[model samples]
Target: MAYTAPLLNKPAEGWKHDLPGPNQPPTRTPNTRLLPNPPNYVDDIYLELPRSTLAIRSVGIWAAVIFFLTSTVAPVLLIDFTVTEGHLPPFVLNFFGLVLLSTFLWIGVYLWRMDTEAPRDEPIRFNRLRRKVYVYRFFHDGAKPFSRTAWGVRPVAYDWDDLHAEACSLYGPMGTGGFIETVTLAVLKPGTHEVIDRFLFTHEIHRGEMYWAMAQLFMQQGPHALPTFPYVPRDWNNEDVSFNLARRLAPKVVWPAEMDLESRTAP
Candidate 1:
């Protein structure tokens, strides 16, 4: 039996999930590049921390710039202070430069590697019919149009039962009187309070709907379910956390009763 999208009787066109809207596709295809074709089998598509190709490519550029500046300046500085001053042997300066270059080279590689798009990871995906958990980096494209163009690595199965989830978000003036926002859902270990995974959602304004939809998806019947968001994780970093909080709220989309009522009542 094909499991329909719960609480909604319609199939979503591509991965454009317009919650609470009428059951119909958008007038036209999205201009953003998607997978050439999504398969008939995927449903309830939720995207976390979607980034652009330009953003992904920028990592390498920044990495190169940092490495270039460091390589150019560090060697000269080491040579000037040590070899020029005759305080250390010539080999000492050479070895110091080599060590400095090697350290920054490793750091640059690690930062660039943090991009999931480079590795084609999904962060999280579900196959309701298969009753198996699909990992961020492990599934096939299913021929569907993707939210973003992939790096071409297929997604595979994740060996986990469920992801216990929590989200932490923040919004503040971008120094131009406009606000900037970011949110991330943490998938924690089922017990013992350990964060095992994280799926990021950048610049999304509707947090409540996103959280409700995810909780519903996880609570939906099947052998697997993602964890539910219990409370609105606090952002202590914001000294004026109350600023614009009420005016910038997202509409409730799902079972609000199941959420952390205590936090829901706060400013």
Candidate 2:
């Protein structure tokens, strides 16, 4: 018969009520939960000190000195013994033994230096001027019963931008003799930082993971391209998932994004 328009019902009382005046700030519910700050690469990340107590540089210098003196002077000194006795004396043989012993000692010192000097529970200070990372370590002196040694490493620095990712790992079973745990920040090139690779064995399992996670959160520009975990697909739309994963990975680390907007915008 006749076409008719349906009538619209009015909204309920509280639903349509006027919001408090524009001048009034919105109510703030107390945030009882403490949230962690995001990771920031520009900011320093503190690594804990390891248990070992060896000075890599000091031991290295001593090793070199021992090697040089024995190799260069031992032969010259032995010439006297050869001329007088028509053969090297017992003392001369002992000296030669010392030279061989010193050579191997140097090698042992070099390896021990790396094992003991890995960074732990300390702030790894990055020097932009020298393009190096310096860390202090403590080493024990067996010869001197109650003495400990301190040393530093001169790792070549790659630009924070060059870091692709990082990883952390433990090499051996718990409670067993193992190298210091390490975190390697993966760079695009090999020779970018020769000093670091030459001295310290940067490649380790858990430490690399930690470095990769922190670097991604701190150093990476723009949006993250890859998912933190394998099962998760890479999707920009899933920021919550990405953010949550990063947070879980490094609770103490802070990201630039997490800084107050005011601080980020400041001149």
Candidate 3:
């Protein structure tokens, strides 16, 4: 299916149309025979997985662009402007220069905050025993990502039944000719189809089923329902040097005390 925009606020649909076989558990979301996205941490009670793949190189690229614009481009523009319009008031020229420099700086900072300032890995936790899902999210206004308001680690708990998964895809920016895909779990507003909230299940389109099935199997049938071999437990703390460094630089995953208790504990 060809999609031009990010899919949102619709009923979860478009999984493989086949019926489940004998081994698969009865689930609202589709199941896959293939292995699920492995958890960063798992136990009898809960399963935890990372939000997205981190690209450290992207950070460096942005940093370089910011440096070049502020140091080189700003000076060149200011010098040219002053020479060309010598009759203009010094303060007016200075103001223009400041605004131009500030715009570039803000763009750099905004991108940095949007990506790097977040927790090293915003993981989603499936508490099977509690029949609830805990999302460690960095909430910001959908329309205003650059705004300071409506932002932070506002983690939430949702009943397993209220959640639905959908596979969404969109074309990348014009020059890039790239494609972007994500499996998203949208939280419904009780009896209505209206979407209350949503988050990414996995960024990979091909493996979206596995990720969805992983959560579905765990929630519907418990930890025993999942595979044991390639889906072995992993320690997020003991990851590679790059991960360790990023973890150190990023904010710690600190859930609110009341929510922490409620999410992990059974009713």
Candidate 4:
């Protein structure tokens, strides 16, 4: 099933001030008063870490089997019994070296598999002031073997001005028991952060048509030169039907010019 759009109840705030066009007048609106008994805000959608114990065990078993076979069989087949004086056979030496290399390869594969299975915690918090979302699961807290393993973690932030859209396909099977295909215009924005403490700018692409609609401000008035990411749709017609219908029925979201500017300039 396609994802549902979230209702934004917060009052629109001033987002941008300096209009790009001279004739365009500044748009302003009254801020929505806070609810007397507002419900607590919580983030429920997030990428989940794979947690398959069977997968982990399977990898472990494979690694052990490979190590045992190589250690026992390679030595027996490669070692020469009747050595001339004290010299070892060249073929035997090469065979042992190959076995050692195979062992190292198996070990590397085991490590990689473990890393891929690392746990991911959910409901990551987003800080508007810092313009970044905090990822809680990618870091370890202790010095143990598993704790020493590092997972890839990065902040999610975007530049409102550098956003754009382009058509692409989304790969996956639809709910109707058929392959889905689509030509959606992905919404993208530029992001900045430190990878290993080095400054870098990366393009952040928002998948699904709903995100594009939610971020309409950028789609309508932001930068026009951004690129779209490729996708493969599972069900093109269904996606289009759902997305377009939602867009038509969704409530209009308005933002104040100054607040728009702040969101655009947020780091």
Candidate 5:
């Protein structure tokens, strides 16, 4: 399916909010939902989550199952014919065996299939000390990737300020229905705003929290910080009610309407 990038407007021209009360001490610290020391590594994590794999893939899992099961029909028919006919030749039986072997082998190929969901130690590591992002892969669960010859993906270290973090939706095949949202953290060339490398990529539902956490990281530690959440807003953003604790947990940082505070500003 076709999709355009979520338009990110840098602090809109002539738009601003009343500076958050300094005495108010931010109401509360920004809570970034992160998986603490998942399985193996110990670094300040920016974002981490399970992505769909062959075993867990909604499409691939079904596809492999469907393809593998369909192959069984041919062998089953051949076996039935040989048993029922009684006078079947030896070559016919051999061919049946071959078909059965091939079917079993095909299914075996996907048995170990899994997505990039690695353990805590072999996870996507973002070191605050080194200013780098490292994606570690492993064949064995408990081993550290430093000495072992494990698969490490292209993880770029950025200056942080140049990293553009956003929550964007990826449209599938257009005909397949809705979009899948992802947490995209990439480095952009200054001025022209060309994307360098999408250093961090996570496809999941909690993209807002990830995006906010990432933004908070860069803003406070990397280059700048903004007290806002990335968009488009979720199911929680529509409510205008004043009573619910869920809504009141955090101040509305996603006000597309309130951002334009020109009229509300002191004239």
Candidate 6:
């Protein structure tokens, strides 16, 4: 079955414990280490963090790989078929070409859509005043590359108390060396283990605890309690050269009017 975002699975069973509240220390050491991507806004009201990982250079690399495979591998396969069969049927060659083209096209479209058309940053807003967390999720058809479903940012809000951090691991095909780790912030039903909604908190498993701690400190003790920010925050709205040139071609960050208002101010 195809996996979708906002996963609604029960909490993984284990010796589960409640996460520490504001003013309490996080399990992992906390530091203000926002590099590469920094918060657009961090104040007493809210901490807005950017979440897009792909850059424009990655797109170019993928395009090069696709070109190399099509130019070298396809011709080699054609020659092999001709030599082995003595005479290649037109329909056979056409069918093979069609299949190859379709496969490549699907992959190319998926990559392009993610790089250019998707939101520049899907930010998560932690409004401490309201004790609510707002997530700007990038929605897509996870299983189908050729799916025509609209791909865009979907904003949602939940009570801060309902969120729990879960560490998840995805192993590579046949249990190979390619391992992916992530921390999901799951929203559970009050007093129950059922997870109603989830948000990706961090891609780096090693630093996930630290990030959670930072959020806790900011929400509980305010910006005064946090450590000195290691690097200068990027001005995403204006001239920030840290981003790749292709990022300029992507859509700008714009939260919905109602959600934007609610997330920035206390009721």
**lDDT per residue (tens digit) for residues 1-267 in model 1:** 122332222221122232321112212222212222121122243222222222233445366458656766766787677756888547866787788887776555443333322432133334333333433332112232232343243334432333322223344434556443333333434543355554443234244234334434432532234332333322222324233232123111121232222112212
Please identify model 3 stretches exceeding 4 Å from their true place. 1-37, 53-72, 80-102, 141-147, 231-234, 237-248
Tell me the spans in candidate 5 whose CA falls farther than 4 Å from its real position: 1-29, 32-70, 79-111, 115-122, 128-130, 137-159, 171-179, 187-192, 205-215, 218-267
Residues 1-267 of candidate 3: C-alpha lDDT, one tens digit per residue: 333433345544443222122124534443334434367666677877667533342463366366546745656777787678785447876777777776666666555555555665678888887778888887655345467766677777888777766665667664669766667677877766578877766775556656667776777677777666544544444545464333555566677899777766667
Best by lDDT: 6
Candidate 2 C-alpha lDDT tens digits along 176-239: 6664444333333433422222112133433333333432332232224212322322222222
Q: What are the TM-scores, per candidate, against the unseen true structure?
A: 0.39, 0.29, 0.72, 0.29, 0.40, 0.75
**Model 1 CA deviation exceeding 4 Å by range:** 1-57, 78-99, 115-117, 120-123, 138-161, 169-267
How far is each candidate from the true structure, as Cα RMSD in Å? 18.6, 23.0, 5.5, 17.8, 16.1, 6.1
In candidate 4, position 219 carries an lDDT of: 31
- Can you write out model 4's per-residue Cα lDDT over 149-209, one digit (the tens) per residue? 4533332333333222222223434456532222121112234211112111111112222
What would you estimate as the lDDT of candidate 4?
Answer: 0.29
> How far does residue 204 in candidate 5 sit from its true spot (Å)?
3.9
**Candidate 1 local Cα displacement, residue 219, angstroms:** 7.6
- Report the candidate with higher TM-score, 5 versus 6: 6
The TM-score between candidate 4 and the true structure equals 0.29
Worst 10 residues of 2 by lDDT: 13-22
Assess the local accuracy of residue 6 in candidate 3 as a C-alpha lDDT between 0 and 100: 33
| Better candidate number, 4 or 6, judged by TM-score | 6
lDDT of each: 0.36, 0.33, 0.62, 0.29, 0.38, 0.67
Question: Which tens-of-lDDT digit does each residue in 16-114 have in candidate 5?
Answer: 111121112222244333321121212233332222111122333345556667667766776687788885547866687677767654553343222
Tens digits of per-residue lDDT, candidate 6, 1-267, equal: 122332335643321223444345676656555335546778889988766544233464357357546645555677788888897747877677767766766666666666665666777888999989998887765357556666767788988877877666666443357766666687888766587776677665656656677788778778776666667766555655355645666677788999999999878
